[model samples]
Target: MGSLTVPACVSTVLLDIEGTTTPITFVKEILFPYIQDNVKEYLQDHWQEEECQEDVQHLRLQAEKDKELEGFVPIPVNEAEIQQIIQGVVDNVHWQMLLDRKTTALKQLQGHMWRAAYASGQVKGEVYADVAPALRKWKEAGIKLYIFSSGSIEAQKLLFGYSIEGALLELFHGHFDTTVGPKVQSESYRKIADHIGCSTESILFLTDITKEAKAAKEAGMNVAVVVRPGNAALTDEEKASYPLVNSFEQITLHPVQ
Candidate 1:
């Protein structure tokens, strides 16, 4: 597709992860599997740590609420034998992941695991070649850049902080996670604009999901649907509804004067 110019009024650019700046494969194939395969070992190793215990407590609470759900996996209480508790937590995590659930309990543990993995060089955050340079250019142009991903804010930081290109956190003005709201909710976009001290019309949101694009548009922000290899296919109607870009290089941002 041809270059797409962002609105001249856009002063802030909000980005989504996974299929937007990073390849979906990295998340599906690398990051998540790292959690599933290693959660048992991670728990065993970090069981004594306060943070790990807190993560387990959260999962336990979430499991309590999920008791009525089919195929719910219960996490054993802390008083249980160490092995049983670890196995319970491990099974619960695997169950949540298999069903593609995005519970905060699941995300919190995953974030900590990913942090260790990234810090240990066992996994590196992957971004498209065009991403870093485009971010740099936008930053130089005085466009405030922020990330809004479903991942926990800590996880988001690890991805960019330990990215293949080295730390890129400096490129962003701030970050937002699902704690603000679900990505497909227009109110979330409005809240982000309010937090950024910008009008909705003066911000641009880029994502691989049409639902999110529609939500941002509903909130009066400029929107773009990002197309990346391994991203889910967009419908023809979606293509017609939003500006599409296969690479960040195709997006030319005109910062507000």
Candidate 2:
């Protein structure tokens, strides 16, 4: 597809992190592996914490529901059974991460694990070379910037706050997670526009996923598919349907109304 131009009326920019601003490797290679490596240890160490216990309880409930559907007998809640439950929750988390499933519980647990990693300087978030400059330019141009990702809000903040480019968290006005709704749902885009206090037409959403672009477009938001290294390559049809840009340098935002 030919070079795509940003809409002139766009006053807000909603961005996806992985494959859009950040490299896919940073997520799939670094973040996911970190979570998988630390999840069991983190869970064991924090089992007494209220928040950790809550997440474990949620996982247990989900496991029970799954077992019911499979016609398995429920485990009684006893001392020995609680130990089994903890192990079950740990196994379930690892399974979810393996499948890359987006569950609130898993995201929350990952966020907690990442907090220590980020704080300890074991991991720093990665973004494309062009991303920081583009973000700064857009912010200077009066375009409101927001992040919409499947990662929990805490995780989102930690990534940007400890990013390789420094605290880019300041550049973003707000963050959205699955808590707002799933990214593929058009209503999620509409809800983001509402949250930003702008007309859907006045916000530009950038993402690597074609389905996400279609959903944003369906919600009447301007959308552009961001093509980056390690991002899933777009089909010819997808490229034709949505505006596609290889870099943020190609994006041109109009003055805020």
Candidate 3:
């Protein structure tokens, strides 16, 4: 595919993680599985910490709200034994993950687990070959950059901070997660622009999801649909509606006059 020329109005770029910068396989084959396999041991190791306990409490609350759903796992509220409560939280996490729910409770716990994993060198964040160099070029050009992903902010930090590229966090000005709003919501894009102290038109957002591209467009931001291996195929209509790039190197930023 030909290169994508970003408009001169763009002063900031917001990036998506899963399928935009990193391969979907890294998240599916590595990150998520790590949580499922190690959640039990992580809980046992960190249960005494206030932060871990707080994560457990959040899960308990989310579990309470989920009780009406069929096949919902329950977290023990007043269980006598610590082991029983831990077991309950573990079960609830497994159930939520199995169903691929993105509740804050689930993300909070997952983020904490990933932090330890990254620190201990159990996992390293993956990025495409062209991502770092392209980002460096943009930063040197005085274009600000930020990340917007469904992953928790802490998780985002861990990924970039311990990335295979080695601490690429310096490349970003900030990060946003679902705490701001769902990625498919136009308002989220607007809120991000506001947070960055820039006009929506001055920010370009890149994602593999057409819904996210559409939403950012609605919010008046420039949008690009990233095409990467393992990303969902875009429809003909989607291809017509948005700029598409197979790699960051394909995107050339035009300086503002």
Q: What lDDT does the true structure give each of the candidates? A: 0.92, 0.83, 0.91
lDDT (Cα) of model 1 = 0.92
lDDT of 3 at 34: 97
Which of the numbered candidates is closest to the native, going by highest lDDT? 1
Q: CA RMSD for every model?
A: 1.6, 2.8, 1.7
181, model 3: CA deviation in Å?
A: 2.5
| Candidate 1 vs 2: which has more lDDT | 1
Better of 2 and 3 by lDDT: 3
What stretches of model 3 exceed 4 Å from their correct place?
77-79, 255-257
Per-residue lDDT over 1-257 for candidate 1, one digit per residue giving the tens place of the 0 to 100 score: 67898778889999999899999899889988999999999999999999999999999999999999999989877778999999999999999999999988888899899989999999988989999999999999899999999888888889999999989988999999988999999999999999999899999899999999999999999999999888889889989999999999999988546
Ranking by lDDT: 1, 3, 2
Cα lDDT over the full model 2:
0.83
Is 1 or 3 the stronger prediction by lDDT? 1
Higher-scoring candidate on TM-score, 1 or 3 = 1
lDDT of 3 by residue, 23-141 (tens): 99999999999999999999999989999999998998898899899899888776558899889988889899899998988988998889899999999999999999999899989
Model 2 C-alpha RMSD to native:
2.8
Off by over 4 Å in 1: 255-257
